[model samples]
Target: MTPPPLAADTHPPTELARVEFTALTGERVERIAPISQGWGHLSWTVRTTSGRYLIKTGIRRPQQADLYRQVAAQQIAAGSGVATPIVVAVGTPDGPLQRPCYVQTWIEGADAASVLPRLGPQENDRYASALGRQVAAVHRIPGPRFAEDCAATTTYPTWQAACLSRIGRLAASIEEKAVLPPAVLYAVADRLKTLTDQLGNGIVPRLTHRDLYLPNTLITGEPAGAALLDWEAAAFYDPVWDFVKLGMWVFEPHPALRAPFMAGYTEFEPLPDGFHERLTLYQGIEYLAAFPYFGSAWPDERMLASFRTLLSGWMDAHGLVGARP
Candidate 1:
């Protein structure tokens, strides 16, 4: 998969970010530069008189509760022995940022995406394994309920309910956009309804990174020393939901490392029965959701052709060719 353009020339440092960083850390800012920014948040690498920190403010108004939850998620990951940036402060930003923001101690590392291609076979395997173990450690932390968003009040009582809510929302978006063929959308949605029960019986609500892939990970010090980034999307859900991103976006693109990564994850929790089926179900839903999310952001033919390939492959794998749209 093509990498998103780096936030090199964009997301220039703003006075609001600088002001908020100073207010949170109580240190005079010596230097501040943009790290990266995406749909949800704007991030910067800051050096203060006392120390360096990562200051991230939302692109628009993010819920104050979600801000607290992001901090909670980061703290939970750190407690699980996962290397996330340490949170310093989290709260409502004064202005211009237009939302709640947080500060974290800056970690020194190169993005795992940039570093992976440079490694030898052994080094790649070792890094993937280390990352797997770290992810599994975080999954061991349990939550009170299953939620897509991190807000406590919005959580669903059952894993099935949460899964259905996610599926319903994505299906609605795709229908509204009318980008995907109705037949393709209906077939996946129907198959999901039949298979959603599989998720119900064995799944447990655990803290999930929600977004975990090479781009969100950092290789620090050594390839073995890694850190998971971007906890704003973190939530309490089935761990396999996280693997949808890891397997499809990460492992599928880098097939050679999938085994080592799983080897490390299975060290913590063995793969459950019907793991492949559950993964396939989530992946189909993810592909459907991408239409609404990426339809405008990505070029039309590129997006449609990619989806046709992915969905066609999925349908073919499950003997749905006779049912293909």
Candidate 2:
């Protein structure tokens, strides 16, 4: 059986705000469902008098609105043929009216997470391969504009230095949360050395989405086409880095989706020589460095668990810790 569309009322906002926003957009904000309110912003969907649209507003951490990230996202989205919300409004230093808020067309569909559970073994593999191919397409985007992270993504001049800098950032955030196992902190640092020892010299760099999680990819009506959204992390880097992030959640590489996705990837880029080995290293480095991005303020249990699990995977690849064999 098919799953029902995500109920529109997932996160309804206040009635008064709805009236005001309606006047603001010049379209009746019939239903304003709050989506997620993160660090400095809140997102709500407006079933307007005319059509459906998404409205994201900046709150406490309002400065994020003016960042160059949207510019990067706009460029990438244009090249990738993906769906993205255009910047509708941005705030000034004054207040809410001046704060950054975006409104764009609301796509009616489900994310990969919702559809994954319903797929058959073969279907899952097919979708994975499709995802892999799409990722390849995203990597091939041409531009020298994102040179800053490009070199870093290709190969580390000094992996140890890079690793330390990364861990220092994450550790700051980890410390803010509940007591983290001292071993986990130490283990995160120690594993970096092990991965660095095996690091290869040169790597290919390309424009990478940086964060292409399942939920970020949208599947549209009946014939279901894939569309990647959320470009806040867009930058030039090893395209493989995108795949590493997408695949990390799979414990053993999902029983259904692993092979086809890899095969599909090879068709486009011929998978980097020693792709598996390098990808493993990239995954570990990326996982540890990302801890703070997600766990900085929120001491969420799940976030910490994911942090450990990612580390464990890293250890498995390098024998960084005492033998698990």
Candidate 3:
């Protein structure tokens, strides 16, 4: 989805004072700059006497438990040797800050999305390989049941059921919002049903970084590797979903990086059987589901037309054709 336009780097005086006092904890607040890229949250890069930190305040206050769960997931990934931000403090609505917020030690680096495209071929390959290795490390951590670990209300005994439930929710949202044409939705729904049927049983769930795209990864010189950011979407899911995301958001658009990333990933864990087919199915599902998010942000007819073109490409790749009901 195209990112929303950045809001000005201004904060209400009262909120700023409260956040500074609460998060800084007696340290002097040097600077507070708005992070304009991400969706659904207001983030600031805060500089203080102690160190630089990231202050993330929800655009709408999230459930307090959900905020805490995100912190827990970040801690778990960091513990597993993944380079994730350390949660510093959390603020609640009852606190001085009205909105739910968390502060974390900010890792200094350029966003991989910008850095990777500008690098020499060798360096680009190196960075992609590093990212793949880091991702694999995160997946190795054992966790509670998929739903319970993430504090999701629903639970499913099988991966297929959970996936279908998620897709169904996305489809419902798209339909209710009138995000895409009925023909496109019908084709995607049909393909997803067939794909679900083809999924094998006994799939084991692992901790997945559900949104592992280039923008969420940081490239640093000190550590000389890729660090993952934004653990809010972390959950217990089929490991294939992570690979699917990597392919869709990174490798598919930048094919040169693919071989190195796969090399690093397979070095740690070998690809399972029928990986390509499963990845393709997931790509289609992900693109279709993403319409609700993108449509809500960019509601223009041109954006809708772009969505249709992308969906058509996905359907064609999967040998599915749209038919109006």
Residue-wise C-alpha lDDT for candidate 2, range 1-325, written one tens digit per residue = 1112222233324564465455456776667777763333456777866788776554433343333354455445554664444544433334233434456567676667778788787667667776666666677775453343432232333433444455565666556652455566567656665665665655544667777767676655433245566665666555666767667653254645667767766778677676777677567767665555555543456776776677776677655654321
lDDT-better candidate, 2 vs 3: 3
- For every candidate, C-alpha RMSD to the true structure in Å: 4.4, 7.2, 4.1
Cα lDDT, all candidates: 0.76, 0.57, 0.73
Once superposed on the true structure, which residue ranges of model 2 sit more than 4 Å away at CA?
1-33, 36-41, 47-51, 58-62, 65-67, 83-98, 120-126, 142-168, 171-201, 221-224, 250-253, 290-296, 321-325
Colliding pairs, model 2? 11-34, 40-61, 91-98, 91-99, 91-100, 92-98
lDDT of 3 at 78: 81
**Tens-digit lDDT string for candidate 3 (1-325):** 1122324443434447445545546566777776766754568777777898887765432566657767878888887788888887877656555556788888878899987778999888888888888888887876566553455545678777877887788788888988777777877887787898898875677788888889899987646488898877778877787876786679889999899888887888788777777777777777786677667844556655655666778777777765421
**Which candidate, 1 or 3, would have the higher TM-score against the true structure?**
1
Model 3 scores worst on lDDT over the 10 consecutive residues at 1-10
| Candidate number with greatest TM-score | 1
Per-model TM values vs. the true structure: 0.87, 0.69, 0.85
Model 3 alpha-carbon miss at residue 162, Å: 0.3
Which ranges of candidate 3 are over 4 A from the true structure?
1-31, 60-66, 222-224, 297-306
Q: List the residue pairs that clash in candidate 1.
A: none
Which residue pairs show backbone clashes in model 3?
A: none
Judge candidate 3 at residue 32 and give its lDDT.
73
Show where candidate 1 strays beyond 4 Å: 1-13, 36-40, 60-66, 95-99, 222-224, 296-304, 321-325
Candidate 1 lDDT tens digits, 90-165: 7463444444778898778878898899989987888888888888888888888887655565788898888788
